[model samples]
Target: MYENYAQRLAVVYEATHKPEDFISADFEFKKMMRAGSCSAEDLRCYGILHHQMACYCIDKAVDLFDKVIGQGKAVDKDVFWRTKHQKMILYSQTGKAQKNIDEALAVINDGSEDAEDWICLIAAYSYSGDAAKAYEWILKAIPKFPDKAALYVYGGDTCRDLKKYDEAFKYWRKALELDDKMYDARYSMGFCYEELEEYGKAYDIWLDIARDLEEDGYEIEKQFPMELAEKCKAVLTDHPA
Candidate 1:
């Protein structure tokens, strides 16, 4: 029966990238678990499917996460960490910011303090409206992951959140220096320029971002660049260079 359902799941996977497709897969996995036929690998896949489903059905996602956690050491440690991380992110999105922050800190205390844990700490603090703590964690994270462009981008974001436009530009510029294709850093740099009234520079940066996103075939992600480009174009029209 599991083999038959697995074959059906392969067909569903090939046929759709839609979240609702996971509903059937989840049902099959639960049936296999009831029959005591599910493996650790199967539970890991179920957890990932739940994570995807969580984007649209968060309550069910949380329930599935709990089921994954109940598997204890049966679930791979990395998979367990990812499930907890997903829950933290979901909590933040659902306005349980403090809970997310507490859980993230607890995870750090439990000795999983890797680069991602630091990044999650920064995000949890930022979401909870504690910019100082967020900035501090970003600083700590930079030394740990010096080659990571995203960390510098997060640093720039923290600076921007605090209205430190010049500092934000410096951090974003550093991120771009590390990886020229860091689109979020480039976009934030343009935003910093706009805040500083450097309209021409902002326009140029945003135009380049739009071109880059289009060339990269990022259909959904291109909207951000396109909207920013239009805003910059409007500013340039108002104050021509």
Candidate 2:
């Protein structure tokens, strides 16, 4: 029975790599595992599925991750590390900043200092209000993952947190240079301009963001950029050139 379910899971995994498709598969896998006949490979596959599902269904993702971790040495080392990394990211998203930081550092200490690990470390440190540390780590990580736009965005965020708006702008500008479609960098640049009292520049950036979000059909994200654009417009109105 478990073998049949495992084969079905493999079919689902191969059919579509989309996250939404995996959510129902993850639920089925969990139910099958509860029947106590799953193989190590079955659990490993389930862990991978759950990790991908984290973007849409966080609580179930965490539970599946915990189940995988509880398997201990039965799980492959690479799979375990991947699970830990995903768990660290989940912790960050769920407001467990300190846990995110600690888990990311632990993964690094365990000799997994890949790009994902560095990115997670930067985010965890920034979220924990240790922007200085996040900046330091970003610098260290740049030489390794020089082309990753997210690292530069984190650098910008740390600089902004320190109130160094000019420096933040430079970092975010570099990030946009690497990935022109990186709206987060554009949004951060707008924030830097706002902090520097450059209302016109900030307004233009937010206006672009609002338009982009609307065009992309990102309804929730569209609201923030629209609000920021309006606020910047109000500022511009108050102080005309």
Candidate 3:
């Protein structure tokens, strides 16, 4: 009862973005927790909710997330590592004065067996300014979770951020092989081609994706990266692919 009502308030708050609604939802969730009415999923939802609140309460939020994790509710879910990831961000934002980034990194290194956990490990390393370790973990994760398209997408994104444009393509290509309909991998690949000044390839990739989205009832102009693609009209004529 408390869980459903609290979630309803959360949903309404999400749609309205009203402070009162947010506060009401938070109050109700706290009430549920105090009453011992929360299930593991409820704890997870409350943890996420607390994270969304302002930074003034972030320490409390992180504690709540830790409690959620302690309940063994993390398998096949991003909440496990994402909590650590968010905690790392908090540490970084405070110049590591409040909490050590190593604390967050340690959690990620240990007890991370799932694919999402591996993804979190990559993010944890990435956020701690260890790009080499992050990239290395990506290599490790891909081999273990060969069919997981999202790992390829994340690996491609990390490589792209490192300015290894060509290497990023290899990841995105593998992602596409795993899931041909992954628009994000395709979009990132288009940008990689553009960065390499392979205009024709960019145009071809974007044009195909734009058409695909249109067929799927999405308005291309309102769909980011789709709109960016249309701006490459001149490339169609100049590169003539």
Q: Between prediction 2 and prediction 3, which has the larger TM-score?
A: 2
Estimate candidate 1's alpha-carbon lDDT, on a 0 to 1 scale: 0.78
Candidate 2 lDDT tens digits, 87-118: 76678768887988887789778987577678
- What digit string (tens of lDDT, one per residue) describes model 3 on residues 103-195? 535655686567766776676666667667779888888888899898888788889889887788899999999889888899888888888
Give per-residue CA lDDT, model 1, range 1-241, as digits (tens).
5445743673474367465677677778778889998777677667766665665577768899988767874568768766866776777778899987887788778977477777778778877778889998888788878887877888998999899877888889889999999988987888888888887788788778878888898767777767877887787788787
Ranking, lDDT, top scorer first: 2, 1, 3
Better of 1 and 3 by TM-score: 1
| Best candidate according to lDDT | 2
TM-score of model 3 relative to the true fold?
0.56
Candidate 1 regions exceeding 4 Å error are 1-56, 60-89
Clashing residue pairs, backbone N/CA/C < 3 A, model 2: none
Q: lDDT, candidate 2, residue 226?
A: 82
> What TM-score, computed on C-alpha atoms, does each candidate reach?
0.63, 0.62, 0.56
- Local accuracy by lDDT, each model: 0.78, 0.79, 0.74
TM-score comparison, 1 vs 2, better candidate: 1
Off by over 4 Å in 3: 1-104, 127-130, 220-222, 235-241
Best by TM-score: 1
- Report the candidate with higher lDDT, 1 versus 2: 2
